[model samples]
Target: MSVTASQVHGAVQTLTQSSDTLFLLLGAIMVFLMHAGFAFLEVGTVRHKNQVNALVKILADFGISALAYFFIGYWVAYGANFFADAQTLSQGNGYELVKFFFLLTFAAAIPAIVSGGIAERARFYPVLIATFFTVGLVYPVFEGMIWNGNFGLQAWFESQFGYGFHDFAGSVVVHGVGGWIALVAVLFLGMRKGRIRAGKHTNFAPSNIPFLALGAWILCVGWFGFNVMSAQTLNGISGLVAMNSLMAMVGGIVAALIAGKNDPGFIHNGPLAGLVAVCAGSDLMHPIGALITGAIAGALFVYLFTYLQNRTKIDDVLGVWPLHGVCGAWGGVAAGIFGQTALGGLGGVSITVQLLGTITGIAVALIGALIVYGIIDKMSGLRLSEEDEFNGADLAIHKISSTSED
Candidate 1:
C-alpha cells in the first residue's frame, strides 16, 4: 500500500522522538550508575570501621534526592511538574520523563558530592534531612537562575556582557554548588576526632585502594554520558564535546600523577577534577584548551587537598571543595577564557560574565549551605556523638561491620 505523505511524515517524527528518548534513557542509566562510584569511592577512602556507613549514606541520599527532586526541585527549576496523568506525561515518547531522569541524576549529585566531604562523622538522619532541603530547595534556585535563565539573571548578563554565562553542562550549577555546600558542612562538623591536635594533623590512609580505583573508573566511564548526553537531543550531540572530555581527563591524570607524587588517592581523583573543570566548556573549547584546563584542575586538586589536610583545621575527607568547588568555578571562568574565538574555541563567551556568574553560584551555595546546615545543626544536631564516632559509624549506626567472621 502506498502511504500518504502525511502518514510518512508522522512515522518519521515518531522515529525521531523514539530515538531521542532512547538516547536520553541510556544517558540517564549511565549517570545513575555513578552513584555506585560515589559509594565505593567513599567506602575506600574512609576508615574500614566506617565502610558500611559510606555505602549506606550514598544509597539513602540517592533515595532522598529522588523524592526531593521529583516532588519539588524539578518544579522550582523549570516551572513544570509531573502531576499530570501518566498518559499525558508519556506523550512524545515520554521525552519529558526521561529528561527528568537525566537531570535528576545531576540533582542527586549535589548530595553525593557533599557526602564525600562530610563522610564518617555526620549523623545519618540529620544529613539526610539536609539533603532533602538542599536538593529540594537550595540547589534548584541556582539551577533555575543559570540553566533555565529564570529571574532574568542570564538576560542581565547578556545585556551587559554581550553573552549569557555559558556553562554547557553545569560546572557551577552542579559541581560548584555541591562542593561549596560541602565545605560549609565540613566546617560545621569540625575536624573528625583526633584528625588534628595542637596544630599537628594525623594522616589516615585509605582503607582500600582497589575499591577507590574501581569507583574512579565508574565515574570516568559515566562522565561521557554526563557530558555528551547533556545535549539532550540526537541532533545536538557533538564529537567535539566527547574529544574535549577525553583530553581533559587525560590531562588531569597526567598532571595529578606528577603533582601528587604517585599517591594512589590523588591519581584516582585527578580525572574527576579534570572532568569537573571541562564540563563548562567541553562543547566550546579546543582540545588543547581542554587539556590545559584539566591539567590546572588536577594540579589544583592535589595542592589544595594537601593544604586543607596538613596546614588547616578543615578535615574534608575526600577534598570535594578542591575537586568540585574550585575546579567547577574554574570551569565556569575557563569557558570564557578558552572559549573565545581567538583561542580556537566557539566563542560568544565573556570572561567577565563567567566570573560574575561563578561568583553568584558560589554565593548562593555558601549562603544556602550555611542556612540549611546551620539550622539543622541547631535544631537536631549534625554530627554523631563522640562515642559513636570513636566506635565508628558502621558498628554504632548499622550494628554491623563491612566484614564479619562467618
Candidate 2:
C-alpha cells in the first residue's frame, strides 16, 4: 500500500517543525549559558571582594528579565503572549514556547551587560527596577521596530535605500542595544570610587585570569548556537554562518593579541569582539569579509577600552560598550558593506540602510536607557553610598564572599 502524496507532505511538514523546535531549544539553552559567561567574566574582572555580587546579579537578572519579557516584552515585540491554555500554547508543536525561550535569553542579556559596568557601586534594588523597565518597555520597542517591523521603519528603509536594514542575527538589536544602555548606566552611576584621583589612575588587575578566559571560551562556544541557530528553522540553516563566525573569531583573536600587546584581558575578550561584530552579517559575508570585520572590531575594542578607562575615566568594568556597543554597531554597519555581493558576499544589503537603522537603534537605546536610568537615579539613586561602595558589594549588599568565613 503506497502512501498518498498529501500524507507524505504532511509527515514531512511535521518532521520539519519538530526539527525546528529542537534546534531552537538548543539555541535557547546555549544563549542561557552565555549568562554564566557574563557572570564569570565579571567575577574575574572585578575586585575579589565584589566577586560574589557578580554571580548573584547575573542569576537574579535572568529571573527578573524573564518576568518582564514574558509579561510585556514578548507581547510588545512580537504580539506573542503566553496567556493561553497549555494546549493552545502548544500549537505549532510548542515551537512558539521554545522560540519565546530563545528570545527571552536575548532580552535577558541587557541587564547582564549592565551588571558589569555597574559592578561594585550599584544599589541592587534600583538596578533591578531599571532592569524591569528596560527589558519590559525599552528593549521591546526597538526590538519590534527592527526585528518585527512594527513601526514601518523597515519599509521606509527599503523605499529609500532599495533594501531594508538587515541584521540576520542581532548585532544591533541584542548586543548594540544592550551596550548602549550599559554605557548610559555606567556614566550615570559614576566611576568606581578611588579608581582615579588627582590626574592618576589606579589599576584593578583581574582577580582571576582563568575565570575570565573560561568565560570567554564559554561565550565563544555558545556563540555558534547564537549565530547559527538564529535561522530558527532547519531549512534556513546555513553552513556559511558557522564558517563566518569561525573566521571572525580567529580574526578577533589575532588582532587583539597584536593590538593589546599580549594583555590577557584583551586577549580573552577578542573573540567576543569578533562574534559581536559578525552577528549582523554572519550569513551574508564571505569568510574573508568576516575576518576583516572581526579584525577591525578586535582592534577597536582594545583601543576604546583603554581610552574609556584612562582618557575619559568612564570605568566600564568589563568594557561592555567596546565589546558590545561599539563592535555591535560596527557589525550593524559592516553588514551593509560586507554583505553586498560586490564584497564577495551573499548579497542583498545596503550600507545606507544599515547605517541609518544602526543609528536609529543606538539612539533609541541610549535615550531610553538615559530616561530609565535617570528616573531610577533621581528616585532612589543609582549607586551605593561611598561607605557601602568602599566596603565592596559582596559585603555591603549581600553580606557574603566567594570563600567561607573564618
Best by lDDT: 1
Per-model TM-score on C-alpha atoms: 0.99, 0.98
In model 2, the Cα lDDT at residue 21 comes to 96
Clash count, candidate 2: 0
The 10-residue segment with the lowest total lDDT in model 2: 195-204
**Model 2, span 273-351: residue lDDT tens:** 9999999999999999999999999999999999888778698999999999999999999999999888899889999
Model 1 worst lDDT window (10 residues):
194-203
Residue range 188-212, candidate 1, lDDT tens digits:
9998998876768997899999999
Report, for every candidate in turn, its global Cα lDDT versus the true structure.
0.95, 0.93
Measured with C-alpha atoms, the lDDT of residue 390 in candidate 2 is 88
Candidate 2 Cα RMSD after full superposition onto the native fold (Å): 1.0
Question: Model 1: how far is 157 from its true place, Å?
Answer: 0.8
**Poorly placed runs, candidate 2 (over 4 Å):** none
Candidate 2 local distance difference test against the native: 0.93
